[model samples]
Target: MTTALIADDEAHLAQYLKQQLAACWPELEIVSVARNGIEAAEQISAWQPELAFLDIQMPGLNGLEVAQGIEGATRVVFVTAYDDYAVEAFDAAALDYLLKPLKTERLLACVARLKAALGRPPAVDESRLAETLQRLLAPPVQGLARLRFIRAASGDMTHQVAVDEVLFFHADDKYTVVRTAQGEHLIRTTITDLAAQLDPEQFWQVHRSTLINLAHLVGTRRDEMSRLFVRIKGHAQELPVSRAYVHLFKAM
Candidate 1:
């Protein structure tokens, strides 16, 4: 029996996907369901499953981190709600991806492709993957994004800020500010530049100079002008959600 590991932050989605997989492929045995990519990485390293279906966006380490951390050989399939514009890197890397509310046909096709690819030869392009990752480090739009390390200049000079903790990137006058649980910190960068460095699924461009984190969104309400206002947890104020970007937060 083929062993599989699934990693998704949403419990309901994970359970639903597990049920669908078991129904469609009865012969497959699921070894684990990880709630976060960090947990997924640990479980995957220990289990070394033959197949892994991972969600590309999660708190802490994302799916790519989990995939890279696996010890032995294993085929990886990514599932995410990121836009098609951002999927080109996956294609260039020769890895498979499924969009949200996964279609049965697409799932089956990916499974079939995996089986066929496994039987013959390595299907991924290692050179292209390397090139794509290298480009990601420099912050490319619609592609893999990397984080920059920041060090505090004064009191806590040893404190290094991991870019992943940032909840939003906003323009405050001339400098850009990265908001996080700790507080906002000013940085010498443009909001556009920071957006390109952030994962699209985690950070959304609501306005010309504001990017909000999807995970931090508590609730959304319509203002008198029909504009949406998104309330974030741990923050006292509600931020404006542009009309053009309101659709992204509707169902969720």
Candidate 2:
């Protein structure tokens, strides 16, 4: 039996995908399920499964990073919630991808393709994967409208804040705090959800719980402990930069 692995942060979604895979390809054996990209990378290294179903966005390393870390050939089927632009990129590189809220028919087609490919020799083109990843990670080109304003709540009042005026976002319990020069406002959205909606070039996730507006970034400083902290213009608060994301400010 062919062994496979599923990596997704959402437990429900991962289980659903596994169930669908079982229905479509009973011969495939799922060896493990990973909760995050870091765990997925570890499992991939240890088991080296023949196939991996990777979620595009995760806490640690993203799916593309995990795929690049694999030592041997492993067929990857990316799962993402992105729209047609990303789908077109996947198609251009001839890579397999499954859009979110996956349909049975679409999955069946993917399974059929996987089965056919499994019968043949491994044909993973590194160059193509690299090109695809580059396109996926890069910020969107000009002319595309980005998030201009955010609606946040303060007490019983709802306020619309311009994106440019925002300083940063912090994950607090079940809600996210939108900080600005004026004050802090609460939003029910999670940082992960906000990351998808914000402009990549304008906002950068410096830590798991923090996403900073790049336009307001003053500079980075290293504490006595050698930990990196980011300073934003007009904000006395300094944000910690997690090791996983420290590379983002290397050139700055």
> The CA-based lDDT of model 1 is what?
0.70
Model 1: per-residue lDDT, tens digit, 1-252?
A: 888899999999998889988877887789999999778877876787778888878775677655544434566788888756237656754347778988899888877776676666546654455344335423456654465654434355555677666667777656777788998777767756776766777777665457887788788877554556778777788886533345466667
**Candidate 2 lDDT tens digits, 1-252:** 999999999999999999999998999999999999889988976787888999889987787656655544567788889867447545643237888999999899988898888899756454555455545655434564567899986678889999899999998767899999888888888765677678889999776568899989999998765667899988998887754465567777
Alpha-carbon shift of residue 79 in model 1 (angstroms): 0.1
**Candidate 1 residue 126 C-alpha distance from true site, Å:** 1.9
User: Which pairs, if any, clash in model 2?
Assistant: none
TM-score quality measure for candidate 2: 0.53
TM-score of each: 0.53, 0.53
Scanning candidate 2 in windows of ten residues, the lowest lDDT window is 86-95
| Residue pairs of candidate 1 with colliding backbone atoms | none
How far off is residue 133 in model 2, in Å?
A: 1.1
